[model samples]
Target chain A: MENKILEIVNTVLENRGKKAIRKINPSMSLRNDLDMDSLDLAELTVRIEAEFDIDIFEDGIVNTVGEIYAKLNIK
Target chain B: MNVLITGVSKGLGLKLTEVLLNNGCTVYGISRSLSPELERLITEFGSNLKWLRYDLSDTNNLKTEVFKHWIGLGTPIHAFVNNAALAYDDVITNMNLDALENMYAVNVFSPLMMTKLVIRQMLLHKIKGSIVHISSISVHTGYKGLSMYASTKGALEAFSKNTAREWGALGIRSNCVVAGFMETEMSSTLSEDQKNRIYQRTSLKQQVDVESVANTISFLLSDESRSITGQNIHVDCGTI
Candidate 1:
């Protein structure tokens, strides 16, 4: 599950011309560590939803890579 | 290509369906009910056309009745035409809230929500899709008793512009086709005098042909218009 999360996150970042995130720490801030703007975050959310068939934003905003995995209930 | 169209039972929407099907594309259409014309087309086209019967005014049920159904199909929708709309004729002071809300549900909310559905599907499948909103010249030039209706179209134009800006990076495009007065059920309510007064303002001095408008929509959806996005192409015959 962690590997899949890492793969999806890195792919999205790579598409946005960011370096591939080799590691995703639970405490890494999405906006600061990943350098994601509002549109980038929106695209990330959409990619996540498409991959898992879940609305990560259904409850609220998530700000970290861990939060996304946790929202998908991935271990 | 898989295309989704709203208000496909009549007027411009119906003409669009005919053109798309004739061009050998699959179409999924939604409307309150099937018209005889649509029924005839269905019989003639067979599997190429799929129909969903749902009232656009019932925006709440749109998820279950429309979007979810398309998602469940597992097919990538390559284009969307937000063509379904309702017009309420009244002065601003005399406008009815209930009617306005109903019209907004069909004209504004439905199209926006439907765009969300198609965009997600397009991104998932990596299909560079196009979306066209059907707007009215009434938005550009005001007519008496059309303020509320025109406001809905203006809202759509605004949304389409922003959608194009946001999604262009993803190779997905959005645009609007501003239509002029046409001879359809929507305009049948207008008296001949009212129609003539409206027609005189256009450079063409005639009602716009629905087929030409439908063909324009097809062109926008094609690869030929790949460079175009966030533009409101007026099919209004210089009505402004």
Candidate 2:
């Protein structure tokens, strides 16, 4: 599951011409560590919803990688 | 300001393109074809006007194509105008399924899909964007053989009102500009008697100016209408 999340995140970043993250740390903040802007985060949200068929935002803003996993687990 | 407007090849769309360019806006237009007037505007405005010619009925691939094109611009879209519409004038009984499906695809679904993308772009850039949906006074008043067309505009007005509610916290605004009968190709089908009858019902007793509608659109797109949203502003010369 972590690997899938990492792959999706990296692909979306690369598609946007942003640098891909080397690793997905649970504590890693998306804005700070991944250098993802709000648009990037929004795209990530969309990708996540499509892949998992779950809305991450239904809970709230997922600021950290761990929060994304947590929401996935909850779903 | 950067604006993305659909249906820029003729009539109200062309007038809108001209008005936006005259106001020094970098306009990105989408339509089925670039008309001669649009070509003239491109020549006059230089790089201020950019356009993509694609049929709005091709809704499935529009998001990816439009977003990719928007990224190439290297700027955030400040305003988005969903002005393209399909005029399917028919009574409930005479409406064909295939034709109605195609009409809904262009009129309702495409604009909703386009709005989703534009809102994403606005959210990503932290831009408090303005969205204006061109509706019609027919939505507010009754007319023969206009039920189908009026329904689509009604859907748009409802969508605009709710969208304003959904995105208000983000400072993004949405509104509908309801226009009256105009002297556009869309209205050219109306006979002289039909046109006169409609015009006579209006307080102004004249066809609504396409340029005036275009100018109102420009105003809604600007910060001047910053406090305005979730409302339908009528430009129908008091027809409704």
Candidate 3:
């Protein structure tokens, strides 16, 4: 699940012409560390929903990679 | 081209569906009920015309029911026509809250939600999609007993402009076709005198042709109008 999330994050980054990250940490801030804007976050949400069939940002704003895992119940 | 259009059971929506299909484009049409005309078109077009019976009032289930389950993420929607609308015509003094909310749900909220999902689909597929919202000249001109209905269209026009501005960088164009009064079921309730009075307001002094509005929508959806976005193209008969 973590690796899949990493891939999705990297996809969003690459689409924006940003460099892909080596690893994704739980504490990593999506907006700060990954440099994702609202539009990028929307893309990420849709891609994540397409893969997991769960909308991470449906209930509330997801600011970090850990919140996404929590939304998908990965823990 | 693959287009998703709402209110395909009748009026401008039905005409637009036919025009798009005639142009060799696949249509995913949504309406609350299946009109016989739309049914006939489905039979004639076969796989090219996909019909779904959906009430736009239920904005909550749109993503699941219409987008995911019906159209599917695999189908790349190249364009979206937000045409379905509920006209709760009443003077401001006689306004009913329930009816107003219901109209807003169908006319404004549903289209807004659909636009969001459609843009997301475009983003996923990396497609430079077009979005056209069907607006009304009533939004521009003052019409008695059309305040509530026109308000919904006004909101849509505002939303379209903002959507175009926000998504233009990604090549996703958004626009509104502000149509004049047409001789469709939507205007069936109006008396001949009232209809004529409305028509006289336009320079042409005749009912706006439904075909013309549909063709304008087609042009907006095609690459022919690639440079046109964030615009309210008035297809009204030069409404003064």
Candidate 4:
């Protein structure tokens, strides 16, 4: 589960083609902490939804991948 | 009508599919080469709609998107609409080869392949169908850095008109609806100046009305528009 959050942050950070996820914590906000934007958020939502078969809203706010995994109760 | 549309992956295409199905229509669409979005819609709307996963611009996948199924049904297709497009900005000299190539792939080749496949289906069914190619006003007005983007629509308009003329005897009418700027995902990058210019030129001085375009497409697809062909009908509130 922890690894999943790390992977999410890593994928977002890699959007800029650099390792922005070098250091992250559970309390991180994808936008505020890593400089991710709405499209990044949307794409991440789709990825998680597809991977876990869950539903996500376009306006749904998620601050961490742990929250995403918890919503789906995935291990 | 058994209408087939492309770019139903999201935005207008997705919405269009939803509207058509809600009104009791069987439709087909393509996106992402293939994804669960189609299945989600199918679960809601029933299996009357089948989606093909193929990119319009990739010539290799043309047959897949166009002819994936329907052969088994053996019914003449009712309508075929090309609703997907790709666009980005680059000043002529500084443009990257990759970006330009991608635009042509989505904007030009994909629609042509889609049309070719749909026409074949129409021929097999011996049914007269109308095709609506979603075009852009960019084909007429010049933007500072949109030469590549505009040219693709221009090519599509030309193709749509000629194909309509050539197939007149075949009873397949081809028409283009030149869309103005809409609140689509694609226009999220526009600046006020760009949006302003588009609205300012219009007699109504407003953004493109999506409902009106939808109505126009439906009309063309219906038998009411049997006489219209080889035309680029502007839906831009008179941006022309």
The ten-residue window of minimal lDDT in model 3 chain B covers B82-91
* Best model per DockQ: 3
lDDT of 4 by residue, A1-75 (tens): 566656755664565364656665656667777677664565466445434545454346677655665576755
- After TM-score superposition, what is the CA distance of residue B45 in candidate 3 from its true location, in Å? 0.7
Question: What are the per-residue Cα lDDT tens digits for candidate 4 across B97-188?
Answer: 88888888888887786676677566545568899998888788776777888898899899998989877765889999888888777787
Candidate structures ordered by TM-score, highest first: 3, 1, 2, 4
Which candidate number maximizes lDDT?
3
Interface RMSD for each predicted structure: 3.1, 5.8, 0.6, 15.2
Best by TM-score: 3
lDDT of 3 at A30: 100
Instruction: Give the clashing pairs for model 1.
Output: none
lDDT of 2 by residue, A1-75 (tens): 898899989977886778887688799999888988775777687677657866687667889999998988933
Off by over 4 Å in 4: A1-75, B33-41, B64-66, B69-75
For model 1, how does the per-residue alpha-carbon lDDT over B122-172 read when each residue is reduced to its tens digit? Answer: 865667999999999999998999889999999999999999999898889
What is the lDDT, from 0 to 100, of the residue B229 in candidate 4?
96
**What lDDT is reached at residue B163 by model 2?**
94
Error of 1 at B218 (Å): 0.7
Docking class of 3: high
Q: Order the candidates by DockQ, highest first — what do you get? A: 3, 1, 2, 4
